[model samples]
Target: MLIVHVAVTVLLGIGAFFLLVGSIGLLRFPDFYTRLHATGKCDTLGGGLIILGAMIYHLFQYPETLLVSAKLAFLIFFVFIANPTATHAIMKAAYKTGVKPWRLGEERR
Candidate 1:
């Protein structure tokens, strides 16, 4: 039980770290496309991992409650669908707005 708790804590911590890194990248990265890439990939991964850790913790802590498990599964499913769709929408909007990608070796003017 203690081990499970520790593992869950560690996983959640890692997920939080990734989320923070993604946010910083979104602010610090040059160009819109690069920022979008960082936010989309890292944020989704962080959110997924965080949800997974929570689900694991809940399963271990409440084995008899199928309702909690089902709820967590549903949350994960929604996030998996929503995050990618949001990212796609952002990318599509950027493309339509003529937001250009940052070319390698090209200095920001």
Candidate 2:
């Protein structure tokens, strides 16, 4: 039980850290595509970790809530699928519209 608690804490902390990194990347990256790449990957992992942590905690605290746990599991699966798909769709649209990639030495405001 103690070990499980510790693991949940660690997972939640790591998840928060990754989420912070994703947000930073989203804000600091020079271009839309780069930002999307950073947030798409990092945010996915971050969210997964956080959800995993929550599920673990819930599992320990309320083992009877099988329905809730299953819902969380489904949420995890949905996020894993949807985030990257959405990113890809946005990138595809941007490319089709001829949005130029950012180049070195280009001034962007």
Candidate 3:
């Protein structure tokens, strides 16, 4: 049980780190497309890991309660489906609107 708790805590910490990185990337990245790449990939992974940690904690601490477990499961499922779809939609819209990428060789204006 102690090990399980520690593991979950570590996972949550890692997720938080990823979330912070994503937020910083969103703010610091030069272009919309780059920001999207960071937020979409890093934030999604962060959220997923956080949710997984929560689910694991719940499952271990309340083994007899199905309600919490069920809710956590639903959360995982919803995030998994919604995050990528939302990212894809945003990227597609950006592409459609001709939001160009920042070329590596080009100097920042």
Best-performing candidate as measured by lDDT: 2
TM-score against native, each model: 0.87, 0.94, 0.89
What would you estimate as the lDDT of candidate 2?
A: 0.93
Candidate 1: lDDT over CA atoms? 0.87
Span of 10 residues, lowest total lDDT, candidate 1: 100-109
How many Å off is the CA of 78 in candidate 3? 1.8
**Which parts of model 2 have CA positions greater than 4 angstroms off?**
none
Residue pair clashes in candidate 1: none
Which has the higher TM-score value, candidate number 1 or candidate number 3?
A: 3
Count clashing residue pairs per candidate. Answer: 0, 0, 0
Superposed model 3: Cα runs more than 4 Å off: 107-109
Model 1 agreement with the true structure over 1-109: per-residue lDDT tens digits: 9999999998899999999999999988888888878898888879888988999998999899978988988888898889889989989998999877889887752
User: Model 1 residue 85 lDDT?
Assistant: 92
Candidate 3 per-residue C-alpha lDDT over 1-109 given as tens digits, one digit per residue, 9 for 90 to 100: 9999999999999999999999999998888888888998888789989999998998899889979888987887888789889999989998999878889986542
Whole-model lDDT per candidate: 0.87, 0.93, 0.88
Q: Write the per-residue lDDT of candidate 2 for residues 8-107, one digit (tens) a residue.
A: 9999999999999999998898998888989999999999999999999899999988888899999999999999999999999999999899988886
> How does residue 20 of candidate 2 score in lDDT?
97
